[model samples]
Target chain A: MIRFEQVTKRYPGGREGLVDVSMQIGAGELVFVTGHSGAGKSTLLKLIALIERPTRGQVLVEGRNIGRLPRRAIPAHRRQIGMVFQDHKLLPERTVFENVALPLLIAGLRRRDIQRRVRAALDQVGLLDREQARPEMLSTGEQQRVGIARAVVGRPKLLIADEPTGNLDPALSLEIMLLFRRLNEVGVTMLIATHDIGLLDQLSGRRLMLDAGRLAADLGLH
Target chain B: MRIWLARHVQSALASLGRLWRQPLGTLLTVLVIGIALALPATLGVLVRNGEAVAGRWTSVRDFSVYLQPGLPVEQAGELAASLERRPLIAAVRLITADDALAELRTAGGFAGVIDALERNPLPHTLVVRPAADADDAAIAALADELRALPAVELVQLDSDWVARLDAMLAFARRAIWIAAALLVTAVIVIVGNTIRLDIQNQRAEIEVAKLLGATDAFVRRPFLYTGLWYGLAGGGVALLLLLAEQALLAGPAARLAALYGGSFEPLGLSRGGVAAVLGAALAAGLAGAWLAVARHLAAIQPRV
Candidate 1:
């Protein structure tokens, strides 16, 4: 579960990113955050992930106020939630297997467990065949899948993705949405930020739309 | 803890593998470190040999005190006994004029000359052995005091070469220390620059790792290990070079010492010495890598 209680975020130069925004999504729910560019969509996800703090108000995840987490506790707090980026952000020099194994590696899992889990995650993303291939050798969609595998490898309770399909075609975006749907069915909570309105039509899920740093609409579960 | 150990091993091996992947660059960096290290190592051997040689050459820093001519033999004996009682002199032996003449008649090949003399001409002498702690100034002070004694003509010191050898050795020791300090700084700079470049080259990877929930400590592990590898290899190469240089000098050094009717022990690196040199190199590498990683990792925040 994620909660933002009247949170406000302002950038360094006195520009408002998100202002007095409050929202909550319960466990086992997959929500779509839709807004145009500069609509505070990324800021919302960043606040939940504790990548940035709200200049005002509080942000909580799983009942713990992340805004109050100590600096030393940040890494452990981050490990609890999986995050995906639009660019995939996989290390170009590493193989797909190594890229997906980053989270579990950080967790200090045994080699056997890491191998088993990495393979299963790669299989879920249909990237098992390219495990040894460098990320630079993979297609953009495939690279994005590798990023998904990485996010879900730790079996995190919540997944936060920032425009994960930004570079993909409509068909590829649909496939990614379907993958999220499969994950949501398995009870992994997800909050995805995207302006691709077509993605919402395909998935038929709850959508929170932001407009100009405010929560303009909260269309509850359909 | 076991799991932590496993991760450490994995990270260390991964670092070494990365170094292996760029064999040419790593080798060149190691060679630079080794060459820098070799200079000091070779100088260390030289300093040690010089100290040993100086010690041997100065082993007998004695003074031969000649009593005034026509002084009674009993007076010479009394002077030797008095000099021996002084704390500065370890021992003193009186050689009567008759003893010197008898020694010359048999051992000096001067029997024909000795038979022609109506009476003995050599003065009674006292051979003075200074204490182990006596240096040039201390011996000279003692000699000056002895020369002021009644009926004492001359106090000839046999320590000229010893003093000269000590001064030369002292200069060499200072020069070696200065050279060692500079080369060590150069080694650290070389390793630091190499590691800085390595961190810059892996900037993107570091950012990604940080984003994937890696601790700063985790991000730092492999780089530290890479520095360890550099130091280890470089130290090994330096040791080989020193050994080679020592080997080349050992034969000639022993031959020279033999010609001087003395035995010389060539400088062979003791186990402790090897450990010390390698440990210092390892520390330098670790420190240099740590400096680079700490400075750069803080700048590489996760790109939002």
Candidate 2:
């Protein structure tokens, strides 16, 4: 579960990234965070991820105040949450299997357990055959899928994605959305930040829309 | 603990693999490090050799004492006998005016002219060899005592040569230290700059890894290992270079010793010295990597 209690973030240039925004995402719920460019959608997700601290209010994940978390405990806190980026930031020098196994490796999982889990995650992303292939050899969609596989390999409780389909075609984007839907159905809490209204229209999920650094609408359980 | 060690080992192996991916560049980098390490190593060997040579020269105690010109030969002989009675005086040879004149004639090859001179110009002299245990203080005390003798005109102790040699050795030692310090600084800067560039190149990957829950230790392990490899390779090369330099100098040193009718031994690195060199190289590499990581890692935080 994720909760933001009147969270406000201000950048150094006097720009309000997020202004007094408060929201709660329930366990195992799929939510869409829709906003135009520079509308603080990514900033909202970052607060949940603890990448940046909220200036005014507390940000909680799984009932723990992450803003007050000690510096040394940040990594442990992050291990409970998975994140995907628009660029599919996979190490180009590493193979798909290696990239996906990174999280498990950092978690200090046994080699056999890592192999099994990475295979299962790649299979979930329909990238099992491309496990040994390098990221450079994969298409943009495939790379994104690899990134998704990497994010979920550790079976994190919550998954946050920032523009996961920004570079994919319409067909690929729909497929990736369906993949997220499947992941959500399997009881993984999901929060996706995107500006694609068409994709939002196709998915039946709670929606939080932001405009001018403020939460403009919350279509609850739509 | 075992798991942590295992991760570090894996990280090191992964770093080596990355180095191997660009063999030429890695080799060049290692060679540069080796050259940097070799300069100080070679100087160290030279200083050791110089010290050895000076030590041998100083081991022989030679002193010259000049007696008054009108002093009786018996008085000079008595003075030499008194010097010989001291435990520190290993040997004392009395050279009267006639003996001194004869030695000068033999040395100068002017016997015919000396025989025609009106009178012997040299004064009575005493040459004293001190015991091996006699130190600078003992020598100075003995020289002062001899100078105070009524039959002695002056005691010109041949300690100036030893003093000059000691001064030279001290200067050389200082020079070696300064050179070593500068080279170490150079090594740190070179490796630090290289690692900084590497961090820049891998910035995106680091951000991604951090977002995926990789700790700073996990990210830093590979760079540390890379620095270790550079240090090890550099040390190995430096050792080889020093050995080669010794070999090249050995022949000439032996020939020079033969001309002096003495056995020459080229300086060899002691066990502790070798260990110090390796340790220093490793320390330099670690420090360089640490500095680079400390300076650059914070600038690479992910935006979202």
Candidate 3:
């Protein structure tokens, strides 16, 4: 569902984020982007999400060139892709239910639909009972699950995460990965960027490795 | 459409709830807006009252056309009849020389001294009342016309004080407009600053919302609503201030008018005036919030 053709990203002052990268992932694929710090993994996902445009070459999603998408169309384009972050990114003042309901609210869904979808998404994350609880009141794992629930509540076609398990312990990190695996099994495309090399065997997915902003390896893609 | 409306309602309530949690900050901001709005509104009310008083005082703008002393009473009566037929002259009454003499003898305390004169020295007079709708310029023009009439010695228009009052009231009205403009601008700035601070405080939330695919409109909804609420409350406070001023001044104003042998009622805001004040506040609030949002919202892209 995503393709990058010889894309290069160079930040201001000539620091290269990604150099001469070209890759493609088909529909419904759960892929992992791995590299050390300062690798181009996050930059690759950002190109797909249209957060930052490529400095050279084309980035396409679902056969559409998103590099040419107008600024006004960015939100709609983004709405089709769910995004999760390492920090959980939950509003501290809102309850778990409210946090999960945010994407639907931003989409301008009806109240009834919002409530129903929020509860269903929370149930998927096994946080149905904690819907009324605040984010700060939840455990670190639970908060991350809430973030996952929020990301998927809109039922986006592609889900991207930038080090989503970075803050969790090994066990909790595995749990989060399994949750992602469950979501992927249901036909949601997943692309996650992480530096945790040990968690790869627990979840079955293609791995694309980056080193010094270069595509060093593409394993399990024969 | 229904879903869109629901989202707006939700945003509005959420903003209101946030302000409610910080009662002191909200109250201080509202008070600042209220005082700004109240200054112009109060001045408007005072100007209206002044206009009301002037209306009562200038109701009758009459002129006296004094005929030559040697003019005959029949000619004066004819002149009064002719003057009454003019379009600008509402009514004309002929005061014959004999009637004037009789009136002076009965009303004036110098009756014996007047009878001591060999003959009556008073001239024939015509009291001409101008049309109620006649403006000052029109009345002056009609007065000049009367002065040019034959046998008329003098045309006296006792409306100079009324004209002065009219000019003063007009100046006051202009001043109110200027004051209202300046104060309205102040209110806009106040609301803009308040919304700016609010955006800064909610920076994290905004980033998250943007990351989650929120359109700029969605992120701006709550701040706009907050501005509207501030404007609404400020308008209410201004109305209350106007009412209080009316209450405090009504009795004294009436007493002062009574001393002048006239009744005065202190006028509060008319329905249109109230609507105007509220509308201005609401518009200013929305504009201020829009400006701040437009400038700052685009700068807060998700860094991740």
Candidate 4:
């Protein structure tokens, strides 16, 4: 669960990225944040992820105001949130299994538990057999799947995606969307920021729209 | 605690494996670090050895008392016996003028020239060996006492040579300190540059990890371990270099000792010295890595 109250983010050069945005998403809810490029969709996600602090007001996750969190504690706050990028961002030098296991490794999990969770995550993404394959050897769709697996491997409470299917073909994008839908069905809180109107048309969820650095519309969950 | 240490160790091993995958670059980096570390360590060894040699040579306190040329041999003998009775004087030997001339003749290999001389010119001498623990002030005091002797012409304190040797050793120590400081700077720069490159290489991975909830400490652990490995390897190489230098110098040192009619053993590093060298390398490595990571990690913002 996340809540933003009058959150504002300004760039170093006095460019307003987000302004007085008030929004909330309940636990186990699937929401869509749709906006044009530079419309502050990514900035909202960054605020929720604690990557950048809001310039004004507070961003709360799980009832804790993370705006006042110490820099050292930011990592622990982030551990509860899973994030995926449009680029997949899989490490090119490591195997798919290693990439997925990174979060667990950082958590200092036992090697056995790490292997178990990594294999299960890869299985969920339909890449169990390709666990040994490097990201460079994988297709674009497969690499994105690896990124998804890596994001969800630690069983984070919140899943945030930043235009995850932006680079995928229609079929591949649909397939990735189906994966998120399945994850959502299994009770994972999901927030996907995208400009894909067609994909939005196919999904039944809350739509929070942004225009000119402010929230312009909030279509309540269908 | 055990589990934590084990995990850290595993992570360190994983990094070492990654380094091994790029052996050429790793070897080049290690060699650079080694050379940087070895220069000062070798200089330290040299200074210690030189001090050891000086210590051995100065172990005995020697002085010479020149008796009046025409003083009677009995009076000179009596003076030597009286000086020997002093608590600081360990031993004293009286040499009459005739005996001094005879010794010069034998030492100079000029028996024919001495035989051709009209008269003996050497003065009676009293050679005094003081207690080994005598200090400079005490030796000077003894020299003053000998100068006041009725039969003595001049009192020559051999301790002046020891003082000069000590001053030279002090200068050498200061030089070593300067060299060590420069080499330490070189170590820091070399290691810092290496870690900076590593940070660049792993920038994307670091960003991804940050997003996934990896703390700076978690990300920094591997680089810290890598720096430690570099330090440990460099120290090992430096120790080997020092041993090789000592071996090479041993033969020459022995030859010089033979020339001086003394036995000399080339000095090697003591256990504490070795530990100090390793500790210094490790501290330099940790500081360098910390600097590079602190500077670079904060600048990496996860892309929204």
Residue B243 lDDT in candidate 2:
84
Candidate 3, which CAPRI tier? medium
Task: State the lDDT of candidate 2 residue by residue for B1-304, as single tens digits.
Answer: 8888888889889888888887997788777777888887787787788789888878767888988888889988888898899999999998889988878899888999998999887898899999888988989998898788888788886767877988988898898889888988888887788788889989888987788877888888888888887777777877887788888999999999898889989887878778977888888888888899888986778765
Residue lDDT tens for model 4, B181-280: 8887788778888989999998998988888888888888888877888777777778888888888999999999899888888888889889987887
For all the predictions, what are the DockQ values? 0.64, 0.62, 0.69, 0.72
Candidate 4 Cα errors over 4 Å, as ranges: A220-222, B97-108, B115-120, B131-134, B148-150
Predicted structure with the largest DockQ when compared to the true one: 4
TM-score of each: 0.88, 0.89, 0.88, 0.93
Residues B1-304 of candidate 3 have per-residue lDDT tens digits of 7777888889999999999999999999888888899899998898898888888768868888999999988898888888788888799988888899999989778799997999889899899998777787998998898789879999998878878998999999999999999999999999999999999999999998888889999999999999999899888888888888899998899899998888777889999999999999899888889888988989999888
The C-alpha lDDT values of all candidates are: 0.89, 0.87, 0.91, 0.87
DockQ of 3: 0.69
State the weakest 10-residue window (summed lDDT) of model 1 chain A: A197-206
- Candidate 1, residues B111-211, lDDT tens digits: the string is 99999999888999998999988766988999899899988999898887778888888898788789877887787778888989989999888888877
Backbone clashes in model 2, listed as residue pairs: none
| Cα RMSD for candidates in order | 3.8, 3.2, 3.7, 2.3
Q: For candidate 3, write residues A1-222 as lDDT tens digits.
A: 899899999998999999999999998999999999899888998888888999998999999999999988888898999999899899999999999998998898888899999999999999999999999999999999999999999999899999999999999999999999899999999999999999886666799999999999998843
How many residue pairs clash (N, CA or C atoms closer than 3 angstroms) in each of the candidate models, in the order given? 0, 0, 0, 0
Q: Which residue ranges in model 3 land beyond 4 Å of their true spot?
A: A201-203, B64-126, B131-155
TM-score of chain B in each prediction: 0.79, 0.84, 0.82, 0.92
Residue A9, model 3: Cα distance from true site in angstroms: 0.7
Best by TM-score: 4
